[model samples]
Target: MSLTADPPSGAVPATGGTLTHNLVNSGAEKVVFKVRSSNNNEYRVKPVFGFVEPSGTTSLEITRLAGPAKEDKIVVQFAPSPADAPSASSAFNAVQPTGNVTIPISAT
Candidate 1:
């Protein structure tokens, strides 16, 4: 699974960036996301990846931190592991999980 966005300039002025997505575990394990970036101006991003469990709904959250925001773009990758890839909600769900989501973080 993967999620990304091209936020308009000044979308997160005080902070850095934001991320939101829905994951669905079709397999029988948990999904793990591997995030990376290039030329990120050093903006601290907090990423949360997991399923809601029982509900089988999955989601990933990326939060921007306060400080000098990086000018780099973000990249996120998800790989369903055998031990954690059964519940979709346990990670994320996709009412449509591959598009733009509201920015929910800001720099202090």
Candidate 2:
């Protein structure tokens, strides 16, 4: 499994920029994926939690809630089922046998 985001980190424009992230699951079993911003007040993530079928792919979008911000961090994590209990809250809170990825965002 892997997670990636475009424009990893940079200054935020006056109109803000849309962050596009992709998550890929190559395992044979289903897995759960989650996305969260270190500072929710500054950044927003949609469909915070969802499932990724085996050999499937998913995408997420993060948008700046306010006009601009100094910096922020977005986390994308995945946890395989059975071994790691599932949760509706966050993947960070769950046991990540599959590890995670963090992307940084900053403002100009």
Pick the TM-score winner: 2
- Give the local distance difference test score of model 1: 0.42
| Residue-level error in angstroms, candidate 2, position 50 | 0.7
lDDT, candidate 2, 1-108, per-residue tens = 444444455445536666666666777877776776787776777768876667777777777755654767788777765445455454435555476767877755
Highest lDDT scorer: 2
Reference-based lDDT, each prediction: 0.42, 0.66
lDDT of 2 at 98: 73
Pick out the ten consecutive residues of candidate 1 with the lowest summed lDDT: 1-10
- Predicted structure 2: lDDT: 0.66
Candidate 2 residue 26 C-alpha distance from true site, Å: 2.5
TM-score (all chains, Cα) for each model: 0.38, 0.68
Candidate 1 per-residue lDDT, tens place, 1-108, comes to 323233412234444455554544444434454445443454444454433223254544544555564344445445443454455344443322442223333333
TM-score of 1: 0.38
**Deviation from native of the Cα of residue 95 in model 1, angstroms:** 26
